[model samples]
Target chain A: MQPAVPLVARVVDLVKNYYLEEVVVRALRGITIDFAVGDFVALMGPSGSGKSTLLNLLGCLDRPSSGQYFLGDQDVSTMDDDELSDIRSRYIGFIFQSYNLLAQYTVVENIEVPLLYQGCRLDERTRERCLSLAEMVGLGDRLDHRPMQLSGGQQQRVAIARALVNDPHVILADEPTGNLDSRTSDEIMQLLTQLNRAGKTIIMVTHENDIAAWARRIVRMRDGHVESDVRNDRSTDRPAPAAHAAGLTASANSLWGGDPYRQPLGNDRP
Target chain B: MIPYLCLLLGFGLLWLVVPLAFSDKGRRSFVLALRSLWLHKLRSFLSVLGIIIGTGAVIILMGFGEGSMQDALEDIKRQGATNIMIRSVKASDESSTARQQRIAVYGLTWADYERMQTIPTVVRMVPMRILPLKVHHLERSVKGRVVATTADYAVVNKVQLAAGRFLSDEDDRYMANVAVLGAHVADRLFPFENALGKTVRLDKYFYLVVGVLADRMATSAVGGSSQTAEDFNDDVYIPMQTCRGRFGEKVVSRQSGSWNAEQVELSQVTLTITDMESVRPAGDVVKDLLERYHGTKADWAITIPLDRLEAAEREKERFVGLLFWIGFISLFVGGIGIMNIMLATVTERTREIGIRRALGAKRRDITMQFLIEAVVQTSLGGMVGLLVGMGVVFAGPWVSEHIFDMHRPAVLNVASIFYSVGVALLVGVAFGLYPAWRASRLDPIEALRHE
Candidate 1:
């Protein structure tokens, strides 16, 4: 009887340009895409391929020079900086590869930054929720450690915990595990994959093919244009190991009250 | 006392030394001015030094001036302007040191007294004659100046008789040898005893003491031959006719290696006016009359008590003005010092300003904070200056009397204190405003980014 809810994100004819002196450089040329709710999509591209630009646009850190971009039912291309910031705090969370955690804040305090920007008071309940987010990112034992005191992977985990603190509608990761070792990269990918399985929409930007393989869908771009958009069917049918699945299931239950590890393969809840 | 000093020092420290206390980015311009001032403390202090010295000088000088003026006024009140003084002088060219050969060039004669009585402005004229001699009373003999005057002398000069009665017209007509003892003369001649009604022998004549006169006050004028130390307390007053007949003006003068005698007319004449308004005009009229009677080379002097009173008042006003200006400078300097410190504080706290701006502080809020600080600094300085000024005023008399053997009147009044404090505050605010305004105009982002 009612029209089904539209996908979480949609872009049509998005064009981005940079002005130097009087000349305009086209960073992105008429890119169009759609992403369903709870879908985990990876964007792969070489340098200056517009992957970071798109992520910045979707995260509301920037606006396209020309085009329409809709996050759920709201048109983001027309929003002002203040409005974009508000939307970013309320609906979209970002995790940068460099782990941009404020050095002054401890792990828990970093996790509470989004809520603070959202004007949330640190009451007993909100503080407990921050602690729970820290636990979900495997930072429970390091809640009091400042970013400077933590190792690279640990700092990234704190950044991840901060990103998820506000419970936004979409998670945008720009090279989420690009700076980590192979072992830590797999661990971080597993964490991101587990988050996606629990109903969160994810858009990740990366240059590594191995990192892209972790996502269910991949979009390849070269020189400001999309080369291909493909579904990774082989990776989607294989589930994570049981012990790792159990741990991820526990973190999922803590994050969004769902057992993502026990879900049937190829479920694609969206 | 230490706590009060500590409080004062704390105020100085906050206003003068601290720089980080006033920063805010939203009020960057305001803060920048303050910072500039803070960076140059020495220059600021030097600039305000003139004001500091000026203020202190004004208060101290004015205070002393006012005190001296009050002293002069009190002296005038005691002298009674209704009375006039006439004295006899010798010719300036006279070279003879011999008393017998020296002539009384223009003495106050009996004819002058008679003529003065005819003037409409003259209420009463008392002729007085004096002769320096040794008087005896039993075994004790004292050298003193004896005077013979009419009964009205006591009334004309406002002299209070402590005992017995003054001479009457009958005593003058009969040439009675009745006398009044001055307070000092009485104490010296009859120590541990009363002199009233007692008989004393002057030269070869015996006189009975009728009364003892009260103490005479001191005068500040000097170098005038007019009655220098007229110790009314030491003088014995007799009837006019009795002094002329018994103790004649022809008296012996004894000096080192010289002995001479001379016969002179009246030594002094006192004129009284009926009203105070007529004193100046009457003095002028008498002077004209005396000039006509004597030649252009006349040797006589006239003193008008009223003119002296006016001079004293003028001196007081000038003194007060000078003191006020001096104090004003110091207060101004103090205000500038406060401004300098406040400016520095504004600069030091630029980041704080920015943060507060981001937290929603308005321009007015920053302005109020800096203004309040300036006001607080100046008010505190004013209060300290007041206390120090008061201490100096109060302690002046005590120190003078004890250590210096001098006495000075306390002149620090409530009005002066209030005025000084008010000026200090005004100076503080006026000088502090530019820095405060500069601080209040700072931009939040720029201020936060300030190194």
Candidate 2:
């Protein structure tokens, strides 16, 4: 088969720095990476290894000090803050380890934030889509719960639903399961893995070896440099059952239905 | 007690409504100020106490000043402006002093009267002679000042006839003993009945009352002169010719084995000028004539009615200035109070300002918001003060006249009210600007971090 997905993002020699009282701290030092559409990749690094810095560069949250970052063919490294925010809102979805949901908003309202920022009217159809997204995340009954009222796992799930609300091209998750217990982490990892198999590109940053294993490919960083970029050969073994991954596949079909591999197989759940 | 309570309740209502109506920022700052005040109720009440006392002081003091001015003006108006009065004084001369050791000698004779008539500005001069005598009507007997003058006396002095006719030139020429009664004299002599056509005894002579003169509006006096144009009310008027023929200028008063007697000439000549504008010139002409003819120092005095009226007017303006400054000080203090409170509010709402800026509010909008708050506080205070001031102005006379036994009329001056309110609003903006500018210049990041 042709390589299953085309290149969706490219970064070349991306460098970022911060100034604190005349001292320059280099957060990202000449990092380079390419991410294909529909690919699930995890960035792995120890503390101060620049994994989060690289993710921020990729998501357009911060600009490079002197380097090039491109989404598809657009060079975003030179864009101003407002322009970068616009590009981020339009093309990238973020899920933080802390599940940064606004405390004042309900679960459904939090999920609706990206749409509201997009100037999209909260009409019946848009509201119905929000409800469906909530249902898809298994939060259909807890749509009105505030962030303070929800458990850590449920809040993370709400953040995930919010990330998907804009139907962005790439999902950038930073330590997505770092704050969860093992069972909840497993559940979240399985959900992310199913999304990747259905052709939604996901780039995650994590220090955990087991969490990095959930991705089909991993990029390792040390001292602000990418040390290795390699595919995980073991991901092909004991893949999740078709029935267990049907919801993810269905959502992915709706998101990117033209792809042939996302079609229903004979053993798929009805 | 009930009316007093009602007044207090009305004042309370005014305190509530006036400030709100005049405040520029609508209900937002009002609500905020109210909330802040409620948060620290004792401090708020203490702050407002300053304003209350200040407003009350302005009202009461200004009210009394206004009352005094009105009384002074009324008293000035009562003295006719067109009448030029000339009075006689005792001349210090050795011969006259020795001849009148027991007599009064300062007076105008027929020669002085002829010289006064020669002045071109004099319209009409009425010569007056007085003799202190005991007059009786029926059972009523009272010591009175009797005057002998020409028919022109009534016209020159602006006296009105209440009944019957005044003495005519025919009466003076024929030496008729017909008299015109003064109002008080009529009241005293007739008591319950009309004094017209009644006979009154004056020093062994009987005179019939032809008319009663209207009550005098004001008392007349010259500066440092012992002579006053006596209230015509107590006088029994007769023609000068009749008085000279019937009761001579020499009169004798005997008491306690001592007798005093003297022959005096005309006591005064009251000249009427054609217009108020000519009163000054006419007075100068009469003074020059008296000086040239009398040839003696301290023999005569002249009074200018127009000059007195002008002096009264100047006094009124000074009184208004004093009152305005008193009111202005309180308004200034109130404005400072607003500024102090607004600066505190700006410090307290720093976080709110950051949120608004983050949400895209402009610097001008932030400036306007705080300025509006300051204006609201001061304007409200101004309006309350104004209403209270006016209330005192209107009710002052009523309370004074009825309860305090003072006959004062409260006058509400619109100019003062306008001036006070305008100054108040200006003070509001003047004091409010610095704090509002500080609020507008606040940095969003720092403001967001402020508690």
Model 2 residue runs over 4 Å out of place are A1-270, B1-71, B91-105, B109-123, B137-140, B156-162, B187-194, B214-230, B246-264, B292-296, B359-365
Model 2 agreement with the true structure over A216-241: per-residue lDDT tens digits: 89999998899999998676574785
User: How many backbone overlaps does candidate 1 show?
Assistant: 36
CAPRI band for model 1: incorrect
| TM-score of decoy 2 | 0.58
Listed in order, the DockQ scores are 0.04, 0.05
Q: Write the per-residue lDDT of candidate 2 for residues B1-451, one digit (tens) a residue.
A: 3245345545644664575455432233455555555566665444444344455555556566666656655554555668777877656663466354766555677888888787776788899988777778877977777889998887766678889999999999999888887788788888899888889988778898899888765464533233355577887788999999987766667768967565568877888777877888878877787777767666777766667666656666776667666666776676677678778878988876654443234455467667656655555555667678778778877888889998776666555554555555555567778888899788654564576
TM-scores of the candidates, chain A only: 0.89, 0.90
Candidate 1 error regions (>4 Å): A1-270, B1-65, B94-102, B118-122, B191-194, B214-227, B247-264, B274-276, B352-372, B391-406, B440-444
| DockQ, cand. 1 | 0.04
lDDT of 1 by residue, A1-270 (tens): 222644888888999998879998888998998888888899998889998888877877668999999887678899864566556666777777767665545688667666654545556766777788777777889888878898888888887777777676788998989899988898888778877876678999999998989888999988778899998875577576454566655655565444221222122222
